[model samples]
Target: MAALRKKPRSPFWFACFTLPDGRRVQRSTKETTRKAAQAKADGWEKLSKERAKARQAHRVIADIYKSAHNKELPDATPRAFITAWLTRRQGELAPASYAAYSGRATHFLSWLEAAADGPMADLETRHFTAYRDALAARVSASTANHGIKLLRVILEDARRDNFIADNPAKDCGLLKQETDTARRPFTLVELRSLMGAADEEWRSMLMFGLYTGQRLGDLARLTWANVDLQAGEIHLRTAKTKRFIRVPICTPLMEHIEGLPAGDDPKAPLHPRAATSKQVTVSRQFGELMAVAGLRAAVNHDASKKGRGSRRAVSELSFHSLRHTATSMMKNAGVSPAVVQDIIGHDSAEMNAQYTHIESKTKRDALDKMPNLLKP
Candidate 1:
């Protein structure tokens, strides 16, 4: 019979069972005897008919996954999967992201080394829970949360590649973050103090940030090509916002830009430009400068007020506040909301004239009111 075909070289017997629906299924029963082939074929034929009937019965998910009991699965480890994932994603990730992912993967490798089992196939919630708790105990909640976040991403990739049936970290809870109540806008009085305390370079940076509402990231990368000295405007496309922004360089910013050493080669950066080649350093240096200036840190809503509130004793201020200070200052100066959003690279749904709340006349008037440190 065709169901008991003789193998050319293999000792095992192969059987082909054609179902009532005409679908053929192949099975190899290690037994060399024809009797065993017939027995195996009969059992397979029965199973095939049952599966066919079930398919006809239920149409939603037809033969999506076979029962795990019937399939020979490879033993995959989280470490192996993550290594493969990083290799695959290396080109797609940004430089900073590549560094961060590499660091997280290294940390995971260190932890995996101590495990008795070779790879992470059935990582349980308790394992993640203990890791999370250990991380929390060792570092800040935010830092610990980041480790879990990276792990979750790695596991998600593993799931997609069929390394695992489901992601174990899917529902693992992360530490809750308090609302970002960091000091963004400095009140008028505080702004004055900060401005007063700033030196030449810091002063130029502060004035530029306050007047343009540009993030330090954008500010650090600003170039003469981006500035239209003739048009009296600074034109830039923000990297983060991906929005076109044009802000009047105004007298303060223009003068500072003009006075800046016209680039060592007129092609070099406007300022030294984030020495660490990082946006974080731009803001970090700004903070250090502020501390030197004896400017008191501004109070944030989330910080412990038991020892804060006074500018001298406050612990909540970041260089980012300058952007908010500019936006708020513009609003206070009556530059219509739409124009403020436009100048700050913020998106607006309303593009129509009727919805155009901010008029150029208002921006001119508001710009006139803005204080320019270069003046006098």
Candidate 2:
């Protein structure tokens, strides 16, 4: 049974409940309204009852196991379980993906140590909610959502393994993400400006990006063997999508590639620094270059903000804009949608739609095809 009542010194309602084992508990509902307070009290009561049921179920299972095997079952802390799971699954995930999952799991365990005094079995939905809020406050909503999704997967695994009765993070909703309007295709003027401002190596990289319609990572890892200068084709398998594509080298890109010094090593990366540096570091370096070209504003980081590091204004342009630029340029040139999609290795028509931006001249030309109905 549970009841909601306000304490003498508190403004919010408190839920007073008793477990099936005769243990009593009192927790703040944090609801000022009576109806909300009652709902919170009911939820607490339900959770307490469920936990009691789970304890009984566990005890029965343990007794059976002990009678059959003459040994007690092993239990693990949340931290220990997550560590073991990641170790077993690391080889199954991509290197970058494994790193991201490991990082998020580490952060969650650290937060758990500071916030909760109980083991994995005692974690509730409310704890996950609090963690979600903390992450949202520290980072962008998209990042918080990503962390929440990873946490859900981890907890869901725990439930599947029978370590926890239920996954606390399963019901934790993701934050709403703002539409990405910052990334846009670079205009011809901006492209020319960037190319002029870039050094020889950067200029070659930019040319490759425009011609091949590939990501920075893919372009950076390009080897001399992938570029067939005589055949006028650049062959690559996209890292993210694993889609193999062959693109023709346009006249400008061909000229740029021919001018570059050809090293003896066929396996040498086209852009050494880009291949070695982390993707984020490479993006930041390109952002700085864009700032130098006056195409983007300079990023400023606030030093005094604790936990929240470097608040920089989002830029409308990035190295990824080159991919958009390639798609748009092809569409505007009257290339077929299928051809553009194949060149860019787009998996879906919806994704291709995002890249296509019709020019005003093309729209006008389309409109001109419609005859005036009122003409005599």
Candidate 3:
């Protein structure tokens, strides 16, 4: 092969060539040194012939992108694409979902800023693995996994937008963390003490949670609109699960709801008028109520505070545990798994939309156990 030389005009080196049209052409080797450029020039000659044949098929751009997969990026930077994705997600996701996504994205950006090389296209699996390991060291597995999940979503968007040819996160193989499945049921002793220790209003909320199996988010937003006095049921259209559930109002739960402070206006909320406020406000007030109840559930004193101190026996408990308590009690009272799923509004499988097949008789039996919840 003839030796090649670097072109003085640009960093690209080229070699002299001839076309079938008898016109002269110079192929860019895009390499340095005579010998390397010469070999690259030879490869270009072969590619030129192939391109001429493939012109009839009109697949040049496809060929170029596929061959240059590692070399080129789409029009936008990774950061810019991520920002756009987040903005689009703001309108698509629920408020709680948006908060979680935004929080995770913020953390991801912080990690990227400290990276040796920026942009997702430039990242290899090693980069993602390192981030995962670092997160695992400092945070719980679930927290780290949430960060990975958010990053994966952003990268998947990038892939779809042609910002990258492939999603680096798709095969990142993050370490799986074991999740604790233990039911955090509030004991009867704990429940009785907490109820007596609290004022009437909060005591009612606690009993309502224990009986209804409704989540804190759902229970906070409960109003007279969701109750059916004639049917003796509490009707709930859950925002998180996007399902409508109607649980029969047992004596204790009904008595609690009936005794709640009510305004003269029938249209007003059954509980304190503020339960329908933003999530943070409701949670803060609930935390105060828990303290007043002599409950050991820890309140978020300061968002800026860090470090996991040794948790008290009940300190690890949260307001969310009330829902778990309800679920556990239902199971203990002979509620079928299927009816439990329906009451909790949890789909049987993560990716499946179809609910688990549960017999109606089993469901009725499970619901029958609701009144017995007062025992525990």
Candidate 4:
């Protein structure tokens, strides 16, 4: 039985109830009227009684199973399992990694609910394949492949935990990615033109990119402490790889660094605006700079006609091209592949090969070194 009562000096009514175990619970009904308070109390009492009965039944069944097998079975719907798994992973993974996992899992579960019309335990390989194909149609193949990879990881964990009989995403193949459309290396002429056109901060960043071959994100967040003018080297820990590298400063870069105003704080970013602004904002500003330099055409999208997916098409030449330019120039200048790899901090030979661009002249010169046994 439940009773409705009002606390002294309080307008709202309270619902007081006792469970089958004689545990009393009191909760504010949040109602001022006696009739409404009585109705709420009655509802609470009914819900408590039903819960008590369910618990009692569950305990009786557990006791029987325990007497027979001495084990408790794990039971949860797909949604419940995934939600709990994601919560556990939130503490284990990096912020960015957790966000990616959460987004993909949430989206897939929503789709699963509509497509399978049942718990996640009933999912099959065909369903995952269908989902992958659907995603590939909606987004780029690379993006679709990322979703598939994430789903495979989630299902593999589920299988390991005995939550699911098998991993449906195990056999699901990644969509075939299209040929890479990565940015090309900027020509020497174009590099010179860009440096001439850039303002002070942009010019400094361009020099750093050309000299260090570091990513934009890493260079933008560079601090005064990282620059060792005495040793003529810059020590950087890459943001993506977390690899610490020491790159010797070139004469040009040194001159530029010397020209900048000295800062008292070693922790202060060398380029304040680049460090503070969002990445997209900086990229867009760089695109505008490209337009100003006549390297790329200016784009104007109509506000009224723009759709949600509409975006400015990527320019052939952008800030990232500076990295390629650095790699290519070093190779062209007769620098050994091993030395270039060390300077650029490439982890593997394969990745270094992708960045290296040997000119026709350089290739021909290397060919000339071969013995003239063919002529003999």
The TM-scores, one per candidate, come to 0.63, 0.71, 0.63, 0.60
lDDT of each: 0.64, 0.74, 0.64, 0.72
Compare the candidates by lDDT and give the number of the best one: 2
TM-score of 2: 0.71
Instruction: Give the per-residue lDDT of model 3 (tens digit) for 56-165.
Output: 23234534654689642333455556667888889889888888788777766677774422334455456677888777776666667777887888888876765555
Q: Compare candidates 2 and 3 on lDDT and give the better one.
A: 2
Worst 10 residues of 1 by lDDT: 57-66
User: Which residue pairs of candidate 4 clash?
Assistant: none
Best by TM-score: 2
Those runs of model 4 whose alpha carbons end farther than 4 Å from true positions after fitting are: 1-118, 122-139, 196-199, 278-318, 349-376
Q: Model 2: per-residue lDDT, tens digit, 197-263?
A: 8887787778788767788888888989898877667888887777777776666666667777789
lDDT of 1 by residue, 1-376 (tens): 3376666788888888875346565668777888977888778777667645543432222122224344222235555556667888899886556767878777766775655133344465556667777766655466678988888888887767655445666657897743554566776666666677766656766777788888787777776677667777777887665677677766667667777777535345555545236765665567666666565543243465422222223235667777777777777877677777766777756643446445444555566677665544
Q: Ten residues in a row with the worst lDDT in model 2?
A: 367-376
List of clashing residue pairs for candidate 1: 296-311
Of the candidates numbered 2 and 4, which has the greater TM-score value?
2
Query: For model 1, what is the error of residue 143's alpha carbon versus the real structure, in angstroms, after optimal superposition?
Result: 4.9
Report the error of model 2 at residue 104, Å.
Answer: 2.4
The best-first sequence of candidates by TM-score reads: 2, 3, 1, 4
Displacement of residue 288 (Cα, Å) in model 3 is: 7.7
lDDT of 3 at 360: 41
